[model samples]
Target: MKPGALTPQDAMARAVAFFEHLEPAHLAALDLIYAPDARFKDPFNEVQGLRAIGAVFEHMFATLDAPHFVVTGRVLQGSTCFLTWDFCFQMRRFKRGQQQVVRGASQLVFDEAGRIALHRDYWDAAEELYEKLPLLGGLMRWLKRRARS
Candidate 1:
């Protein structure tokens, strides 16, 4: 079914399905949710088009052991839908023996066609990511604890 034909709830459902189907080895589902010229931005990446967006996901999957997107909530207004997502993944830094789980949220905007036109993520990079990395994680946690005390 075409994205535009689906209701807001259906559209959100489709997006969820896309995420669920996304695997570390393949990325064909992105073509279903993001417009061909969609603009996606985050702490590490700022780019347009599905190819670039797919690359971001590819990189994450490559670096992380198991990466996935969990949609927590969604709001629709007119032709736009704001989606709250929790991106979860496990990454190993510098040949570490184990992987670490990293999570973040994103606010997504969809076009009338139900394709993601813009995706702006909202999360603390220092706390969620930088603080999870090997060396930086130690420094960040130290500073955080020091500030709190």
Candidate 2:
């Protein structure tokens, strides 16, 4: 089927599949999944354009070890789709050998061409990631404890 023929859910599924084993070479083909003007945002970065979006993934590959995403749930409404996923990876420098998992969700909006126009990821960096580190984890955990009733 043509790209434009895909429903929003199909497009979201394709993106999910593509990210499961994301590699640097996949960045070059992002245009097939994302529109040229696509805007993407997550806890650490916010960028526009497919090239910039590709840069984020490139940086991810450079800074992490075997980073990948597994979609766990999907909900579709009109031209928008929400996907709950588990982001798995190992820190390249810190705690270098253990696998880490961050639970999160993404909101995606598809353009007329069925390419993703907006992709925003939602997750708590402190809770899902920072608290998993060795040094920062202690401080973050202490902070969390102090804030609780």
In lDDT terms, which candidate is top?
2
> For residues 8-41, what per-residue lDDT tens digits would candidate 1 score against the true structure?
6666677767765688555776767887898989
How well does each candidate superpose onto the true structure, as a TM-score?
A: 0.80, 0.94
User: Model 1: which ten-residue window has the lowest total lDDT?
Assistant: 95-104
Candidate 2 lDDT score relative to the true structure = 0.89
- lDDT by residue (4-112, candidate 2, tens digit) is 4677777877878887868888788999999999999999999999889988998989999989899899998988989999999999888888999999999999887
